[model samples]
Target: MPKYIVEGGFNFYEELYKSLDDELVDTPIPDDTQNSTNDFNNVCLISNLPLTDKFVTLECKHKFNYMPLYNDLVNHKKKYNTMERKTLKCTEIRCPYCRNIQNKLLPYYDDIEISKVHGVNHISETTLIMNQFDNVSCKSYIAGTCSHEYMCSDGTTMPCTNSMVTLLCNKYYCANHKYFGKMAILKEIKIKEKLELHAKILEAKKKILEEKKKTKLAAKMVKDLAKEEAKKVKACAKAAKVTTHAENIENVIISTQSGCVQLLTTGKNKGKSCSCAKIYQNNLCLRHHNLINKNKPYDGTGTNYGNPEQAGLWVQWVNGQEPEPDTDPDPEPK
Candidate 1:
């Protein structure tokens, strides 16, 4: 049999649906069922089994470690003196925007042409080719990692004479990169904003120091006045003297004006406290401390464990195959 085939008729699947339902009953078989010739049979044979949903994951790595575009390329092209050298080389970097690898890798120019013109073909192409070996090709893939364009093209094929080879990843599906690229671009814009913020903070800091000095001077003036009042109060009080011949003192308890506080007479830090007993010994206050940091369990392997879309934890959900790693523990969890 061919690898794939198509069956017809909408009612053909009725038997398949009935097969799955335990409530289905046909106790009253029609007497002339053989003559009807309209029952579902050929539509769902054991051989016509629907293939289980399948998905393939591409393992793509960076091809060009650096971007093909360089700062000096434009200047060189304008002067007709410097040629913009291709910078895309083999490496382990993802397309900064798509977070993907290339499916197809085009050369900067023809290897054979450059080899013939410069007496060597491997230097440029081989170096670039070495960087992109991790690319993979699944059933469906697309390319959007390169900034190359086809020039000198007609209704037919693109002219290859001066064409720069493009980079692609093993991934064939491209819809994911439409949003992925935007995120990468946004990161670039954030870098610009960060630089501006740094400058603004420096200016703010300079003004703050000037204001801090003025506040310190004002605080000193108020503190000096409070000291004068304290000296006047000290002049009215007398100091008691201690005698060297005095015997060892006994524990004494003292109560404070606050009803909650009273002094301790014995034990550790004797005569220190009886009313100010602590709830816990740990450094964290009673209100904030915990004997153990409790963990809130995940409670779910995922909301819809068997369902891919509902689970949202793994890419395997995109296909109904339900990969085994999700159902069971992985050999390695990195």
Candidate 2:
């Protein structure tokens, strides 16, 4: 039965029981609960805060707070330009995440209520409606927001309409600040980078063309070598055919014993007749006659008709008789 009393004399137990009887429940969720449990999709990728009014959406679908994005762009304009030659322009805007070139950042609107905890302003529907009537095409420069402010040569601070109009050092100044002096060194560096990139591209193209030419030349050489080899093979085949025909003609034998000249038939020498003039019993020359005497019982005495030291073989039939000759010899060798 102890009572907790604090400033303004408020009774904690009395109020707590009264709220419980009224079915009043107080649930306190931590502020970082959403940030810890969910992905950072709803948060700005740049500021790492929740998105609210006056945000910019890039073509890559990444959202950023407007002021931070404008400041980043302004910083890039003052710093070095690292984009490729294709997107090399003074007003080039790029996404910080992917470094992809973007022409403009589209406006992103949220319908959340303005609160001190959110720390963002709420853009009304009337403002959007009036923005349609704005003559300036650039959305970031609308209502003189995110526009460049520079000190002119005449000791005057002037604001530029849009970032589209830019110079070397102080970016996006009006035409009156043209003669405020330019950074010649920065201009030279940019020109040198562009020239080097162009030279590299030309060199790459030249190398590709040279490789193509070499490939074509190699193909042609192989084709010509193949044609030459084919010609040599055809010539060798023709020469072999002619030589075989001449040898066949030289091998035909003629017989003059019975007043009849004909090629041998029905023997091992059927396709090739004898070249000798003298014949044995079957009208075969000594060389062709010896072919039939193989494996026959040999008589001690035999005659080699042509010469004793000749390449012809001689043997006498002991028990077997000579085979009967064909009545009609074939006109052509077998």
Candidate 3:
């Protein structure tokens, strides 16, 4: 038996070895005799155990942060060797305590002898094989009745039932026909454009109608003004015609009485003689004849012509002599 010296002496050694043994009992190891001792020494150092032992240990002199019992280090080394031998090639190596990749302190170890010789095998170059779906149907997914569970790389879960999936160039997608699919998005954009166009059309039509109404109103106003102007012109023409006819009638009366001189009988000049140079009917001037006839009473009617003085003039003119001027005849009897 080789005697070993723990840095913390025999009392500390007993306590540390007991604890390390308990921990190493559950640890796994790798196989391969050529580098097994070296790999085991690395594991012991990582576990904060001493690399030297009373019986046998590696000759490599590496410094450690904490001292460990030699017996515990040997035991842990044995466990690592056994685990290495039993494990399959290309298996991942992780830290037993932290469960993270043991990359910093530990070297790569595998069951493959050629891989160890070449030292080309690395944990970073490892690839995981994904499981394939043999019974999944693409047509059923498009029909919105798929029963597959689609999982994303970020650990998100989604069901395939009542959903659409589009496959293109070895990539999968979730297609939402009502909103998010490529065709649906394009359709929405088209509908929005159509609505905008329709609104513009309606606005243009409204403007056109408004313009037409303005035009029609202007035309109607012009027509009303024209009609009023026509009425005014017709009224002025009718008045002119009436005035011309009256003037013609007056000229005809003057021509007929051109040389008449006759006593008048009616109206304000009833007792005066006509001074006209022309005469016709009843030896009276046309003016006097017309006036007398205008004053004549109807058949069997009373002779009240509203003026007594006019009646007296008519009586005097009918006697065929001028009436005497008004004067006091003779002094009445005192």
Each model's lDDT comes to 0.35, 0.54, 0.48
Ranking by lDDT: 2, 3, 1
RMSD of 1: 42.4
Q: Model 2, which residues run further than 4 Å from truth?
A: 1-180, 183-190, 251-282, 285-334
lDDT at position 159, candidate 2 = 65
What total of clashing residue pairs does each candidate reach? Answer: 16, 0, 15
lDDT of 2 by residue, 1-334 (tens): 7655577988777788998867644655459967755655677888898887667777887778776765566565445666634432433577777788865433333443322111022233333323322322433231222234577999998665543443323333333333332333345556887999999999999999999999999999999999999999999999999898777666642222432233456576664444445545466654444445543444445443344422222322333445443344433332
- Model 1 per-residue lDDT tens digits across residues 1-334: 3343336634545666887564447455468766533332222121232222221112442222111311122222224433324333233212332345433222233322322211111233332323332242343233333332234546453422322223333212133332333344456557877898999899899899989988998899888878877766664442211222122121122222222133334456455333323433232222122212112112355432233333443454345444343232211111
Best by lDDT: 2
* 1 against 2, candidate with superior lDDT: 2
**Would you list the rank order by TM-score, best first?**
3, 2, 1
lDDT of 3 by residue, 1-334 (tens): 5567766455676688999998899777656786866665554545455444321222234433222322232334324564444332333333333333322222333432322211112332112111112223456355333333567899997666555654422334444322233343356557987999999999999999999999999999999999999999999999999999999998897666544445445456555545554554555554445445545542233233324544565576676757555453322111
Return the TM-score for each candidate structure.
0.15, 0.29, 0.31
